[model samples]
Target: MKSALIILALSFIATFSNAQKKVLPVTNVTTGKEIYAKHCMTCHQVDGVGAQNMIPPLIKTDYVLGDKKRLIKIILNGLKGDLDVNGDMYSGEMPSQALLKDDEIAAALTYVRKSFGNSASAVTIKDVRRVRAANKTISK
Candidate 1:
């Protein structure tokens, strides 16, 4: 009976382990570009040059290549108030993209980071999840 119980436990563990494992989608530059074109390109522009005296450019900006957590939060929670980018000031209201799925946000951010003449690591779904969870706690 003990041996049977042990076998059952092992099977449960194996099943749980397999259930916990997830295969994330491969990061596609084309998908990212498409997402950007659909959602971001309007403001940031295809060149990511942004509008002068209004939208801040994403090119090589510290905000883009800086702390991953803050960047993710900005995407999830949106941004307001004064922002200085490369000696210019922008006070535009960046609405929350929290409605976007985690993968979509990651892809868009990854595209932004890797493109616009900026070379940075891709933003993963894990990164987005962590920030979203933390933001929830902070808001509550």
Candidate 2:
């Protein structure tokens, strides 16, 4: 009976620790929402549906769910001129968000990738850093 109690206690502790590990992603999501509200929501809108004929929507578009590096580059380098998404065309300029920290960018993107009917992996700060570094090489 004493051994059984110890086993139960261990199991509880292990489960609790594992649950704690899951919270980090939730925290990131929360932070991303806040950042998006401040920096992106105006153009992308609260529902992630962008303005028609101007700003593009974030709703499961290839730009939001496509290559991680390319997505990151858009934030870092900004996009301009004609671009097509889901049969729609947007020629408006997207200003660079390179001013945001790497982690901020990651969280914002991770939130985007997981939101608006999208289901994708989270973007990590490390991924942002690597992409940012690579972009520098291409520019020069």
lDDT, each prediction:
0.89, 0.91
**lDDT tens readout by residue for model 1, 1-140:** 99999999999999888777645553567778988898888998998999999889999998999999999898888899999999898998898889988888889899999998999999998999889998999886
TM-score of 1: 0.81
Candidate number achieving the greatest lDDT relative to the actual structure? 2
- Local accuracy of candidate 2 as per-residue lDDT tens digits, 36-113: 999999999998999999999999899899898889999999999999988899999999999998888999999999
Candidate 1 error regions (>4 Å): 1-26
State TM-scores per candidate. 0.81, 0.79
In candidate 1, position 3 carries an lDDT of 100
Give candidate 2 regions above 4 Å deviation.
1-27
- Report the CA-based lDDT of candidate 2 relative to the real structure: 0.91
Q: Cα miss at 13, model 1 (Å)?
A: 24
